[model samples]
Target: MSEKSKNEPFGDLMKSMNQFFHEKPVKNILQSMDDFFKNPFPNSASFHVELKEKDENYVITAELPGINREQIQLDVINNYVKITVKQLNIFTTEDENQQITKKQQSFQQSTRTVPLPHHINEKKVKATYENGLLTIKVPKEKGKRISLDGNE
Candidate 1:
């Protein structure tokens, strides 16, 4: 008889053998832990906007990083402006040094809608993108009454 066989009890050995063969729950728990650690942020995307009024135009700037231009959509109707950004997740697997390597990649996606303080000329709206920043210029509506007209 082997030394290990002699040292271990028969009942304990049988239980261990059963556990090794029936490992579905253990495998599920391990997989859940792996997914939890790999995805710390479930949402995976965020954004911020800055609005400024300069002379005859309202300048709106949005910060979007790690996203492609094709995944972004913009719409302006009346005084409401809507912006949408989408990003896809990419996963890669490889085997190195007898170990599995997994790499997860994701991009930014967000949407924002805001009402302009004053009406704008929709036909004259212009948008520009540079270094992951999107700048939109909307010409202010002409002859609009100022709210502080009677205050001063």
Candidate 2:
């Protein structure tokens, strides 16, 4: 009976019914679902690393927690040192009914590739893990020592 909606299909009656149900708009609902999937999920990111030059050697340190030595890997490819780490998380929940639920998740690895200032001696490289920290030592290639005495 409203004059504003007098020519509308099913007119004022449908408008009043819509207000009663208080249904959410389609766009708003879709946006909320979109935001839910965009965040609140675990992801893989690079680990923090520190590189230092020690005379004829390069010292690399990385912070790795909640992981074992077996899960870590290192490789020298080209002129870069590739460091990879794999991590696994276990979650458990229980209620008052003495029921238990366990969930295991395998996350993507965190890696870092560092290039050395000079060519490294692959045979003399060394790495060690201690207290959640990974340390690597890369020795530089020895240069030929030439004596300048005007001697052929």
Candidate 3:
């Protein structure tokens, strides 16, 4: 084949891509993605969490802004910690005659679970939430040391 044949395929590919990008559907999809990323909270299920080990305890700090303590739930099961947040929004519009014009209700819930390398004492776990920050302290379970020496 001639060199022109090889270059023609690449040129055609580029042209097709250029046209695809200009299409309305592709443009809308791209715009939607851009708008989604532009918002800090794209979905209700997203939050930031930090987990660290400090002084024989696992400390977990989660950032849950605009949420109240009543809407948050914490659980520790099988060495896994689960944090759940549920939010409910209600909006109502009333007309001049004291009649309800429009009523809207929305509920959003998100859960985040984290696993720890060591076992934690579920009964001794402590959690506190203040100012949109949730702090959980899980105490590590004590393990008995086994000696390797052979004995009767």
Q: Is candidate 2 or candidate 3 better by TM-score?
A: 3
Per-residue alpha-carbon lDDT of model 1 for 87-106, expressed as tens digits?
77888787876464887998
| lDDT for 32 (candidate 2) | 76
Q: Which should have the higher lDDT, number 2 or number 3? A: 3
Candidate 1: pairs in clash? none
Instruction: Give stretches of model 1 more than 4 Å off.
Output: 1-44, 92-108, 144-152
Deviation of model 2 at 37, angstroms: 22
Judge candidate 2 at residue 148 and give its lDDT: 84
Predictions ranked by TM-score, top down? 3, 2, 1
Candidate 2 displacement at residue 104 in angstroms: 4.2
- Per-model TM against the reference: 0.54, 0.58, 0.71
**Cα lDDT of model 2 by residue, 1-152, tens digit:** 56655668676688777775556785577677787787634354667899998877889999987679998999987678989997766676777886786556757677799998666667789999999999999987777999788657
**Model 2 weakest 10-residue run by lDDT:** 38-47
Global lDDT of each candidate: 0.81, 0.81, 0.88
